[model samples]
Target: MTKFLKTSLGLVAATSLLFSCNEFKVTQETDGSKFQIHEKGDGKTTAKEGDIVTFDLVIKAPNDTVFTDTYKRKEPIVMPVQKGAFKGSFDNALTHLSAGDSATVYVSADSLFMRVQQPLPPGVTKGSDMKFIVKIKSIQTMAEFQKAQEEKKNNEAKVMENYAQKNFPNATKTQYGMYRVVLKEGSGATITAGKSVKVDYTGKLINGTTFDSSVGREPIEFSVGQGAVIPGWEQALMMMKKGEKSIFFIPSNLAYGEQGSGPIPPFSPLIFEMEVIDVK
Candidate 1:
């Protein structure tokens, strides 16, 4: 995740440099000190097949008023720029870019959706010219990236077991390696053998350290059979019905197998005190 953060940060920082640098239109003979792209790149700029990309993009009008910038987001937006994900100039500009390339294109105001609160202020056409600079960062080959990341996280969940042990001094066992001292059941969720359901839950390592919990602000809604909840959650919750509450001490393999996220280390056990808030 930090790596992803760094890549986004780098993309945003690139835009800041534009303030002091000269704009370069697309050309082969352009100086190498800074990148100058005129016509959009002739490759796949829109992310496809799980590619992660970072780029410095600029939007402008014929009058040169800047409209939007990803730099303001402070993080390079990450997403697969697929068909229908973006329309108009944003989509058109990306249609011609590939990994690590940049481009500047003129998008008609009509295509890019430029808005004016007041009257057109004289001669601005409804489909006036809009300018933009774009760059492509990195690309992944498949959606397996999410799964790979999850596996890496599972490998890191080991440190969480100690957290549960330290905190759940009196936690009792339920079914499928789950445990908790009962709180108000409050009418939990109902589950069939092969149905999807949502749940509110929290998890901690054995050392009383809490790893994660959705019990604070709002109840979490997720499908039971879908990979939405962890394996342990599905296993434990399957034994429960509406209004059921239990304490669950999940083994590492059942939780995050090896990799951890933010705080939990690899191969961690989790103890959850859960109340089935709702089910569907």
Candidate 2:
């Protein structure tokens, strides 16, 4: 019968999500590296700087207790092997390692990582031996890596701009030190040089989820181009006619670029449906 053992890491961290794995098979090692690790992966793999690697690895503590193993986590660990990106035992182990090379490198617990890490079971100190199994899925050069990142950024920017135009037909934009909206259609009220307007608006996310609203809640009263709202919004509302419901699709640049609006993360494209209920 192929029966697997149910296991926990040790005496202290019994409730810790960090757990034991099958790969830490406990096959006695003479060196007492204090732990064991194995990989359920293809024999060998390669890696280079700036490359992203996914691997199924197992790690165990000196007392034959398991701390973590990719097998138990049921997910491959994604590591970006770059100078500032990686540090400590894991990074050191990956240094200069190419595709197809398998290692059972032993590391002292203290040397394991150089990051803000959670403390393991009490007494698990530096110099405690640990074992690991690493398999490199692939490698990419710095140029290739940066290119991919830029492409993703560009695509996202394009998507935000495209979505803004589609959702807010009256979304005109110009950057004069500060983002401003120039024109807005469908506002029913006659917008004069100076007018106090009260508007009802429902703002939504790209997915059409409402984030902010003044509909059936309370009427928002403000002067047009008074800088009370976002730049795009200020520009849009100034040209709106009273009694008209206008939809404003605004890009992050004209709205909140890299820094999104309330509850909205960075780079979020905004969609606002507004009605100029009154103009005084």
Candidate whose lDDT is highest: 2
Question: Runs in model 2 with CA error above 4 Å?
Answer: 1-153, 160-189
Q: Rate the local accuracy (lDDT) of all candidates.
A: 0.58, 0.59
How many clashing residue pairs are found in candidate 1?
A: 61
lDDT for model 1 comes to: 0.58
Backbone clash numbers for all candidates listed: 61, 12
Which consecutive 10 residues in model 2 have the weakest lDDT in total?
Answer: 176-185
Flag regions of model 1 displaced more than 4 Å: 1-190
Over 1-280, each residue of candidate 1 has an lDDT whose tens digit, in order, gives 9999999999888876774354454322211111245433435534553354446666666776776676653334455544432244354345345767666665545533533334443334775655676666655545655665566556543434344467666765555445555555545444754565556777666556665677666877666766777787777767677677777777767776655544554456667777776666
Model 1 scores a TM of: 0.37
Candidate 1 global Cα RMSD: 13.6
Q: Please give the RMSD of candidate 2 to the true structure.
A: 12.3
Q: State every prediction's TM-score relative to the real structure.
A: 0.37, 0.41
